[model samples]
Target: METSASSPSVSDTPPGHTRIFLVVVDDTEEMRAALAFACRRARATDGRVALLRVIEPSELQHFAFIGKIVEHETREQAEQMLQRMAAEVNRRSGHLPSLHVRQGKPVDELLALVREDPGISVLVLAAGRGKEGPGPLVTACGAGLGSRLRIPVTIVPAGMSEEEIERLA
Candidate 1:
């Protein structure tokens, strides 16, 4: 479905029965772990899941000389990675979630997906990884999506043990 900047989700939800979740992940420990929890929780709640992995255009542009080659390669890699994560979740929770990968800004693409999918009632984000340094800061930046989206967003810390996260899931 086509989505505008003003409106991100494009589908309609039922009055009160359906719950759609938008879970964004990247190639990070926190993102994977958080999604694992979110997947389990979604399964228990009988909610539909949309797993999103954002591929930054800038990152792709930097290697423009091999853009075509790298783009397809990276996309495949990301797809495989997401599929594995989803598989793990399915193993634990018996839910196979939908997956999507887009080339653009992480925040912008995530917000757009949320707007386009009307079924989405909540957003689940993984916490930043590592100590208070550049890596953690960059990863944690996704938290801004919570404040930006109209739906409620749950942010899970990256450091949580799988068991700890599964309890909530």
Candidate 2:
């Protein structure tokens, strides 16, 4: 990739190159497929991909009164999960991809990473569940993340089949 002093955004192309992708990963199946799709798209477009995983703050402390009823993964556990997910993505891509792990709110980390790295031209995210549950209802939190980010974001809905996902790839 080439960097120019005049531009605010970083270009993924190395003068003559054409494409690049940035995918944000989470512990969901949908997230996995989205990353795959992004990789596939990048491959088709002759671009490179960056796989990032953000660890959200623990929700356990808020509901400590419930006492073990709500089982949440630790940050380390989440990191492990992210590694597995990254491995899966790498397998499909047939290359060792760039991986990033950060601690903070998901949206905040994602946006900050994008701002810090100009190579990331697109953001791929899994569509989160709504209060009613299932099938892509608009959640304020999810919507806020998409709206706040400077780059374009593609939200992969939950429960998508591999075949369905491959089409996007």
Candidate 3:
């Protein structure tokens, strides 16, 4: 696991305690909605947004050299994606978010981050619109995993409009 901040820490709250909204970053279209919701909520509540991008283990492990190259490239791509999203989060919330990159199963990494970071007060995800159902993270959380988490999980609907999210948040 690797973690870094996009800019100078934006999590410094007026009060000693900070409410960190954790959003898992991915390539899915629904991910935008989750990010938007989290940013708006963070802005409204004087909280901070944290993004976690989990890179699945490469299948090229059989070729040690190739695996190492693949791992480096994958991590680079994840960092780039996080940088782009961090700009959006900063624009919306007036604070740059802390970025995290991990290699493992998405659910496992997410759970571990939450357990390790007590400042993470909420886990926000967006439900998928595909026939495959509400995506793996949402499905996993709904299947009792959410109950095990110390923080509350917020699942945003994929089709929700920006205006609706702004109003709700």
Query: Which of candidates 1 and 3 is the stronger one according to TM-score?
Result: 3
Candidate 3 lDDT over 3-73, as tens digits, reads: 68746442343323777888999988899899999999999988889999999999998899999999999
Q: Please report the TM-score between candidate 2 and the true structure.
A: 0.65
**TM-scores across all candidates?**
0.75, 0.65, 0.93
The alpha-carbon lDDT assigned to residue 139 of candidate 1 equals 48
Instruction: Tell me how far candidate 3 lies from the true structure as C-alpha RMSD in angstroms.
Output: 2.0
Question: After TM-score superposition, what is the CA distance of residue 90 in candidate 2 from its true location, in Å?
Answer: 2.3
Superposed Cα deviation of residue 9, candidate 1 (Å)? 13
On TM-score, the candidate that comes out on top is 3
Q: Give lDDT per model, in order.
A: 0.64, 0.58, 0.87
Comparing 1 with 2 on TM-score, the higher-scoring candidate is 1
Ranking by lDDT: 3, 1, 2
Which one wins by lDDT: 2 or 3?
3
Cα displacement (Å) at residue 79, model 1: 1.8
Give the candidate number with the greatest lDDT: 3
